[model samples]
Target: MIYRIAMHNLSNPSDAEDIVQEVSLALLTKCPDDKDDIAVKHWLIRVTINKCKSFHRQFWQRKRESIDDYLHLEAPHQRGVMDEVLELPKKERNIIYLYYYERYSIRDIAEILHINANTVSSHLQRARKKLKSILTEGGTYHD
Candidate 1:
């Protein structure tokens, strides 16, 4: 799950692996105080996202091509859809991943992302509309 989220965010297998390793180190060093399983999951997610965002700020990120050379979905069309998803703005992309792939409710997504439930809902709605329009029209995806 962590690797998938990292892959979704970074779009590069190497970078995603780096993120997973960094998150693992964090887990070893700074484990969350809460013993609740849900809280730990959320903490790891938060840590992973923070690491990905920090990675984006590095100067090298601008020079690297955003490509997933390692991921080959079972269906050819899944790759196309994933490419479109990768093109989405980061916030909407994360929201979409959480809502759909993670099977998270809007309220749960809101809590996980530390945003208002309405904001999460709005993001989800807009992301859906954008995906629908882009996908239904053709394979063309615009930034």
Candidate 2:
């Protein structure tokens, strides 16, 4: 789960691997043994998200480069949709990835992301509209 969240945020497998390692180390050193499994998972996810955000901030401060160059390599045909998703703003992209790929409910996503449920729904709606427009413009949207 940590790796998936890192991949969705960072787009690079190597960066995602680094995030997973960092999260694992943090968990090992900081996590309380008394916490339940679910609580531990949530703590891990929160840490991973924070790490990804910090990484992005640091990278932007240093390089000001676009994330496109770091995107995961996929087949040519599938790249279009993936690219469209990647082109979304960070909040929308994270919402879409959590709602769809991670199969998380809006309330769950809100809790995980530390946002309101309505905010999550709004982001999801806007992201879907943006994706639809992009896909339709590319003549790839069927419905």
Candidate 3:
């Protein structure tokens, strides 16, 4: 699950491993003793995703001297079109990662994110359009 989240976010193996460990520790510490089996699992997954988002935010908040240097240094080694896909807005990026990388159905994503399925679908649509545009345009090409 952590692997999937990391891959979907930026395809960074180390980041994914870190998230997995973070999530595991969080579960160990924060998991409610009285929660049911399903609830425990759900809580773990939710926290895992939040951790991935946190990691992304932290990475983006760095004080790099040059944008190009930052991109070159921070870009994760991912599969085809990863750079393009991540160029989409954060909401779109999260929706796509949840659906594709995490293998969550629309309903599952909605439940996980506490949003409606329609909203999830809308984000997915927008993400797809943004991704297609990025790829067709041959990358966002930020300098």
Candidate 4:
């Protein structure tokens, strides 16, 4: 799960692997002993997001490229609707991945992301709208 989030955020496999390793080390050295499974998962996700944000900033400091160029570098199998999902704004992509792929409730997503539940809902709605448009235009995805 952490790897997927990092991959989606960084769009680079090596960076994602590094983040997973960093997060795992942090978890091993600092994770609270009393936290339950759900809490641990939430903590891991939050940490992964922070690391991804830091990496993204560093990447921008190094260079810039068109979205099209980045897309071209994506794994060959991430085509069609998956590609469109990858094209989403970071926040929306996170929400969509958690809500649909991870099956996280809006409230759960809110707590994990440290945002209001209504905000999570709003992000989901907007993401769905954008995905609907993209998929429909290509006739590649449907309800």
After best superposition, candidate 3 residue 141: deviation in angstroms?
Answer: 29
Clashes of each: 0, 0, 0, 0
Residues 1-143 of candidate 4 have per-residue lDDT tens digits of: 99889867876666777899999998999889899998999999999998888886674434433334444546655555566787788888898888777889898899999999999988888888888765355443222
* Residues 14-63 of candidate 3: C-alpha lDDT, one tens digit per residue: 56667788888888898889998767766776787677778867845333
> Residue by residue across 79-105, what tens digits does model 1's lDDT show?
788888987888888888887667788
Each candidate's TM vs. the true structure? 0.85, 0.74, 0.61, 0.78
Model 4 lowest lDDT segment of ten: 134-143
List lDDT for all candidates, in order. Answer: 0.81, 0.76, 0.66, 0.79
**Candidate 4 Cα outliers beyond 4 Å, as residue runs:** 59-77, 133-143
Lowest summed lDDT across 10 adjacent residues in model 3 is found at 62-71
Q: Against the true structure, whose lDDT is highest? A: 1
- The positional error of residue 88 in candidate 3, measured at the CA in angstroms, is 2.1
Steric clash pairs (candidate 2): none
Model 1: residues >4 Å from true position, as ranges? 62-68, 133-143
Best by TM-score: 1
Candidates 1 and 2: which is better by TM-score? 1
lDDT of 2 by residue, 1-143 (tens): 88878866777767788889999999999888998987787788778888989987664434333445555456554556666877788788877777766677888888988999999989988998988754355454211
